[model samples]
Target: MRSGARAVLALGANVGHRAQTLHAAVEALGATDGITVEAVSTIVETAPVGAVPDQPDFLNAVVLVRTDLDPHALLAAAHAVEAGLGLDRSTKVPDGPRPIDVDVIAVGDLGDDVVLDEDGLVLPHPRAHERDFVLGPWAELDPDAVLPGAYGGRVVDLLTRLHHGEGPA
Candidate 1:
């Protein structure tokens, strides 16, 4: 990432003081040097995505950021943010709700098929195409950045569909 490269981050949480966790995440990210939060969508409550549902709904939001840090560094910073807020790595259930969940949605101008996680950053998120928790709030910030072709629907359209259908928790 250069001086002007921007990335979108998707955040969600459903357990143990959710709203406060969201606030903490925003604060932590904002506090990280070389990173500036450009935009933030409203904190919306939605059901959890994927399985292992024995939990409550989540407060989800998307953050647009301008950073000079590379995608891998930014991802490390995000993980630090989560850990700073008390994320237990011991939890084995993947995608399962917790005190906080921060995901790298898109980085700079990366492609959908590209894998950033191997480089310590993930883009277009591995499961973003199937997640309303991420897509709904994400669309609020950068609807045009949504995937193309089969996923041509604007973020708003996806949000609407999710709200109208069985989505998020």
Candidate 2:
């Protein structure tokens, strides 16, 4: 059997029972094959980012999991959970409100960096560091968390930098 890889996942919900949706999503992730949720951050409320305005604020949280599934497989599992939670990708607007959103923040060490722009999956989420909704809760869960890639840095540092308007270097 292959050893499980440590992964970080960001969760958010803005429509219908936000907190409950986040909780259920975490539970669903734990119940998935080859995935075991080890830790979860406290959920925080934040205004939505990007386009698609005139929506409710979001409840966001982060989870750490040990998984035997590879990057793409894990992404598939996340999408499955979203589907089960009634997140219809077909009808949803880009960057719009949703019942649930799950993003693969990072996977394993990969030491240098892991870049995958194909197959609808991106490792070490391209914009994770820029979003406080992702970094804030993540920092609470793992103070020492360092994003795994070239643009990566300490989670808390990234959050601080963002707060100071420094952005990622």
Candidate 3:
């Protein structure tokens, strides 16, 4: 495994062979030269996390990858996987159904104050601390992981609670 920093990527799929897409995503990340998958959280059945309604349940998981790529590059690679798997991103939408959703949850050794935003990608994934779908698998992968927000230890704690309930929203 390439040793730079480990990043937790949250994967969610609600349509079209969710398990296969998740597995393919793992393969795709492994396919990248600079990124090697270290561990993957077990698949979690979750509810929608936003205002979207009447959508199918999602199959979500967190993947811990050891990578040397910067946050933007890693995000771009994830977007590429979604695109390669037929996720449409031509429109500006939110919380709706999709083929696959991949997001960078946390980065290894980064303090809570770290954040990134360029083009469309954001580090610590803007909503990770508040969403169970992200935090559930995230905590499952790294129970002691710190987030990029001010939630401190509260976020992970809340995650353990929400994880037992529904995803979000």
TM-score to native of every candidate shown: 0.82, 0.94, 0.85
Candidate 3 is scored at a TM of: 0.85
Choose the strongest candidate by lDDT: 2
Model 3 C-alpha lDDT per residue in residues 108-161, reported as the tens digit of each score:
655454656465655556677677777767777777776655554545776765
Please identify model 3 stretches exceeding 4 Å from their true place: 111-115, 154-156, 161-169
| lDDT comparison, 1 vs 3, better candidate | 3
Superposition error at 17 for model 1 (Å): 1.2
* Candidate 3 weakest ten by summed lDDT: 160-169
Q: Which candidate is the best by TM-score?
A: 2
| lDDT over C-alpha atoms for residue 5 of model 2 | 96
What TM-score does candidate 2 get on C-alpha atoms? 0.94
Q: Rank the candidates by TM-score, best first.
A: 2, 3, 1
lDDT of each: 0.75, 0.89, 0.78
Q: Give candidate 3's whole-model lDDT.
A: 0.78
User: What lDDT, from 0 to 1, does candidate 2 have?
Assistant: 0.89
